[model samples]
Target: MTETQIWALVFVALTFSVYIYIAWRSRVRETRGFFVAEQNVPAIANGAAVAADWMSAASFISMAGLIAFLGSDGSVYLMGWTGGYVLLALLLAPYLRKWGKFTVPEFVGDRFSETVRSVAAVVAIIVSFTYVVGQMAGGGIVFSRFLEIPQAGGVAIAAAVIFTYAVFGGMKGITWTQVAQYTVMIVAYLIPAWAVAHTITGIPVPQVSFGRILEELNALQAEFGLDQYTQAFTARPQLDVFLVTMALMIGTAGLPHVIIRFYTTKSVRGSRWSALWALVFIALLYTTAPAVGAFTKFNLLQGVQGQPVDALPQWVQNWQATGLVSVSESADTITSITNKATVFADGGADLLVNNDILVLASPEIAGLPAPIVGLVAAGGLAAAMSTAAGLLLVISSSVSHDLYFRYVDHHASEARRLGVSRIAMGLAVLVAIYFGINPPAFVAQVVAFAFGLAASTFFPLLVLGVFWKRTNAAGAVSGMLAGLAFTGSYMIHTLEVFGTSAHEYVFGISPEGIGTLGAVVNLVVTIVVSLATRPPSHEVQEMVEQIRYPAEREEVGAN
Candidate 1:
């Protein structure tokens, strides 16, 4: 085995060891310990945990890749994801903690009705399931490249590791696991960026130090005629880009996995603090990613735009072996010359470049040595695996705690409830693996779909259900169902037709841009339905009031 191979194995072992250690320490026998970390998590620590868990495989791998390849348009993810959580802090976090349920669907059931709760529960599963597969795919990619495992084998191993930590550690395990993951992923992402930026522009953190990068990049663009995506929006002078950002921002606040993090803190103050900390953690990686991406893109053009095909770099050869990169082959002399060419004349140089390699390739592009590149592979895996575990915990709890305990056995013993939760968690991991192996042809594209779906379906439901008491069960149900149906159908159309690339489908309404419109549909349906139906019972109104202000009442407690 190669030295880089050994380093990769050592890195994985070190990360897994920490998770095993935390799991042993944080293991809980009761349902409370398993699902909610006993609600004793400190604010800053929980924020760090939330940030670690929420910034998954896609963020680590694709965020920079998108920025580098797509140029400024990639900023949409940076703004949408980070800005969305601001809404989570301002609007959702405190109230949910006060309502104090073990799971999000539990709160939905309580606020609206059993029906609304069940519907929300199902929707949560869809969003989480679709997104988790992306994480699993990332894990497989990491193992396939770094550890030399077959892609299928690597994915299964990831499933097994996620199962071990998530099922046994529960939220408690996932929380601390994420703490470790955050460390591995952020360090992995930032160090190379620091080195590259310093070498190129004499800055460590690229986001704050954009002054130099901007100057260098503009010089390159001016000399080379580099067409950037962000320039398109700026040149056109329109609000289409603005609307897409709003959809991502609103949708992020509504993601179930992210919201559940707030519930771990001990107090409302803790909740707010956690959001701030999480932002700091997220920003550390976020700021550097775009600069890394842009630099990588700039370098790629300079190196390959007119290079001979047979002279492709060794790194490209390694990437092709992993199937992450694909190319069309030809032998005609001029066509051979055309085949050798990297960048195309009109635009879009290489369709062969995987959207997932930006982070992994940053070290090499900057001419960093072998060991640092190996470290990046490990970091990518940490991002993917840590997120898979957190997602599994939620899916498991949805089944074992919320569905089984709430509906199947209202009087089941605590041990019995915990047992069922474990079983459900086991089953969910298997299903996630299944999806990973036979992932729908559009797995990558589904990342946008998950964000769009979450923003559309759940954000509105959670907001009105908590803050607006007059939103009767009928309205709540209608709003959620309408969002789910409209978005689901649109998503099916998106997947069936578009695969992954963005297009001007029906007046520039791309899948990523549809959530706001979906939320609007949900809101309209909810209002119309609420007016059409009887007001919620006085008891339900009282429940909404209780959730709106959780910090005040220590009276009833978690019965």
Candidate 2:
């Protein structure tokens, strides 16, 4: 194997060893321990776990590339994701903790009805599974590049690692493992970013250096006859950008895996504080992303602009061989060294560059040392694997805890429940691996679908369930179904799943941005349906009131 490949394997092995040790140490015997860490995790540790879980491969690998190419328009991801944590802290986390549920569907089931619970469980599975596919695809990319394996092989390796800890140790094991992963991923992300920032502007702090980098980038883009990176809106329309950002922000609060993190905290206060800490950790990366994107773009333009394809740098050649970067000649002359348009843009350009390769290739593009390159690989793996594990747990819990244990055999023993959870987790991992092997689109694109779905189906229900005591089970169920149907149909139509273009999108919103509309649809449907139906029973309203007041609750133990 090459030196880079060997270093990657060594880092992967060392990280996996640490995760295994933590999982083994935190092994649980009861269903409560397996599902929610016995609600004993400290606030800070839970915060780090939430950070690791929230920032998936999309944030680590693709966000910078999107910012690099889309320029100011890419701030949608930055603002949407980080801003969502604020929504979580203010609107969701503490109240959910006070309710003290193992899974999101359990809360829905209690507040609404068993029927609504079943619907919520199905929504959770769909959202979690869609999200897991993206994480696995991200892991596959890291493995394919660093470990010199096929994408399928990389996905299988990730599946095995996640299955080992997630299936065996459950949430208790996964929580501690996530804390370690948060450390690895953040360090991995910051090191190369700092290196690149220092190289470009003599600044060590990437977030602080971003302004200086943007100034330089503006001058460079003008010189190259391209659009300015500092422009407020470049590739996408401003309204669409705003809508997409809103969807992402609301979607963050709606994501099932992220919501479940609060369930592991020791108390309602811990859950609230945990959201703050989670954002602090997440911001460490999110704030640096634009800097990474800007600097990487500046570096690439300096190296490849006006340079002949035959005389391109060794890194370009290596990337070209991976099929992420391609060169085409027209009349024996190379026109463009890299295409900056979206990957899904119609009519493929001559020099097609995959945005996903931006971060992975940034170290080499900056001419960094081999060790740093290897570290980037490890960081990407940590990001992808951490998210995959969290998503798998969400899917497993929905199936085993919500559907199987709750509905199949409510009288089953704890041991039986734990066994069913492990089996469900294993099956979920297999399904995710299969989808990873044959991904529907780019990693970030698939993840956007997950966010949109979550925003549409869950965000409205959760927000109104807590804030509006009049929201009945019928309204919640109808609203969820309407949102899912509209969003799914819109996606199918826009994505051209039926081999014909419907092109009936509202206000020119892309599939990624449609979640906001879906959320709106859900809200309207909920209000209309609730007005037509009877209000929630007094007991349900009392439960909502209890969750609202943290001081009125007693700590309930597992049955």
Candidate 3:
């Protein structure tokens, strides 16, 4: 194969080997070990794992691409995602760690009732399933480009690998695998960014060096009769930005896969420390994303905006072969194009560029080396695969641990529980592959929907469950169902799948921003219903009070 393909295969194989080895080495026999890594993972390792899990394909493969095109509006994603971690650490992580539950549904079930627990389990399954779709699609994109395979082939290969580790390794194996993935992801992301930043701005610090590039990008946009790249509210409404940011922030706190990371830590202190370390690891990538976005935007405009269709760069041509990027004289038929409004204005250059391919193609667009491109391919896959494994575990635990063991067979043996969990994960992998092949939206957007759903369904429940002692089982159930139904239906009605027009949106809010409203709905319904109904039992109230504080007995025992 080609040099880039060879290098990509080499890095991918090496990383996959490491992941499989870790999974095999760390495989667990007991349910506790499978679910929470025996609650013995150190703070630093869990932190890196959390960072890797949270970043996902959306952060590594698609966030910068969104920023490249959406410009200043994309800052909402950066702010929302990072800010959500702060919320998680301060408001949720330590409390959950204090409770020391294996899954989020377990917390809900214990805090409320068995019925609420079952509902929460179903909600967790739905949210995790939706989230995995983006991961599969992201992995497919990376493999299709670098490995020179069809997207379907790429997705199947990734599914098999994810199954090998996630189904076999459980949470213990997934944890260590994610730590390795974090190293791969961060290095792959930063190295190319460092190289390009230094090459273009003569500065290696991409985060601080992108100001000059942003200015030039704005100037290029003005020349092309397009809106300035740094201009905000031009592509999206102001309210939508605020609402979407809120959804993403709370959504990050609410995501089950992310929350479960804190539960893996040894103590509440460890959980808090893990959050801090995760932010440190995450910031390394987040700070540099703007630079990568700016550099890619500048390069594409300067290098290919008006270039001949037949004479495009090899990277563009390569992507075009995957059917994601299209260049044609016809404006209506192209898949994606920057500034389509301006490009169509004067017998214009019809250069269609899918945002998903922008980051993967960034290195080649900047004329970086084949090895760097391959490294990036591996990084993107790492990001996708890491999150995919975490999501599968969530689904497995929700079904086998939360549903089957708790409800179907209350006395099921450890071996039976593990078997069911693996089977659930295997099924989840197959379903995720199907959705990956037929995705509802671009990677980031589909993930946005998941975040929105989580924010609406779980954020209010978890927050109220922890802080408000009077929150009864009835209220929690009503709030969760209301929030989920509202948010899910709104997304279905407004998203492209249902063909709803933007004009029909509720007060001009986009599907991505509706979760903020849904969260509010949940909070209101929960509070009102709780006030009207019987309060929680004295024991449940005491449990809430205890989880609110540190687990001193456990801490003393451990010490």
Candidate 4:
């Protein structure tokens, strides 16, 4: 094996060993332990788990790429994702923890009706499955690139690893495993970013070096006659960006994997504090993303601009061989002596830059050492694996606990439920692996669709159910179905999933932004239906009040 592959394997093996050790130590014996870590995880550890769960492969691998290509427009993901945690902390986390459920669907079922719970469980599965596909695909990319394996092989390995931990350790195991993952991923992300930032501006801190980097980037843009990197807006309409941001924030609040993390914490206060710490851990990477993007882009321009094709750096040739970067000869070429690759060329050997390469290839492009590059590869695996484990656990719990145990056989033994959960988790991992082997779109795009679905279907229901006691089962079910239908249909139409062209859109909103409109429809439909229909029973109203107050939680615990 090559030295790079050897180093990558060492890093991957060490990280995997740590995860397995944690999982082995935290093995569970009962259904509650499997589903919610027996509700005993400390605040700091739960915070790290939440961070690992929330910052998935998309955040690690694609967010910077999006910023690299979209320029200022990419701020939507940074602001939207981080801001959603604020909503989670203040609006959802403590209330859900106080409500005290093993799964998000359980909360819905208790608050509304069995029918609503089933629907929410199905929605949870769909959203988690969608999200897991991106994580699997991201793992595939990392493995395929660093381990010299096929993408399919990489995905299968990821699935196997996730299955081992999630099936055996359940929430208890995954929570501690995620703490380790968060540490690895954050370190991996910041090292190259800081190294590149210091190399460019002599500023060791990337977040604080934005002004200097931006100035250098704008100068490079001017030299190449390209659009200024510091421009406030680009060809993408500003309204569309705003709507996408809104959808992401709402979706983040509603994601089942994220919501379930709070259930693993010790108390409502732990859940609240965990959310705060998650935001801090997540912000470490989110804040550094733009700096990484800007510096990577600047490096690319500097390396390729006015340089002869044959004289280009080895990194360019290496990535070009992978088909991520390509060169095409100009139609009108000068004498052989003048023929060269130029960023400003109308028809020269213009570089067709794929944005996804920004993060994965950053170490190589910046001439960093092999060990740093291997750490990045390992970091990518941690990101994908951490999120995949969380997604798979949620899917497993929704099937075994919510659907099977709650609906099919309520009297099943704890051991039986645990067996079912492990089996369900394995099956879910297989399904995600299949999708990863044949993805429909880019990892980030697929993840965005998952977010849109979550925003449209779950966010409104959970929010209204907690805050508005009058939201009966009929209204909640109707709102969820309406939002899902509208959002799903619009996504299908806009994405041309059925091969139908989209000639018109409501206010020209893209599929990514349609969730906001669907959310509005959900709220209006729910309010109107609640008014027309009977209010919830007095007992249910009391439960809502109990959820709103921490002191009443003792009564709930007694149950």
**Cα RMSDs of all predictions?**
4.0, 3.2, 3.0, 3.9
* Model 2 Cα lDDT, one tens digit per residue, 163-193: 8889888998899999999999988889899
In order, the Cα lDDT scores of the candidates are: 0.77, 0.87, 0.88, 0.86
| Structural similarity to truth (TM-score) of each candidate | 0.91, 0.95, 0.95, 0.94
How well is each residue in 221-322 modelled by candidate 3, as lDDT tens digits?
776666889899987889999999999999999999999999999999999999999999999999889889999888888876556566667887788778
In the range 1-559, model 1's lDDT, one tens digit per residue, is 8776787788887877887788777778988888888999998789879987888888898778766655667767889889987889888998888877688888888888888777777777878898888888888888888888987898998788778878787888889888888888888888888887777777666776655555566555554455543465542223546667778898889888889888889987788889999999998888877888877766655555445677666666777787666444531111111111234333333425676875787677667877788888878988888877777777887776667776779998988888888888899899988878766643346677788888888898888887778888889888888887887676666555435543335565566777888899998998889988898899988877776664555667755
Which prediction has more favorable TM-score, 1 or 4?
4
Separate clash counts for every candidate: 1, 0, 2, 0
What is the Å distance of residue 310 in model 3 from its true position?
3.2
lDDT, candidate 4, 407-449, per-residue tens: 6788888788888899998888888989999987778888988
Among the numbered candidates, top lDDT falls to: 3
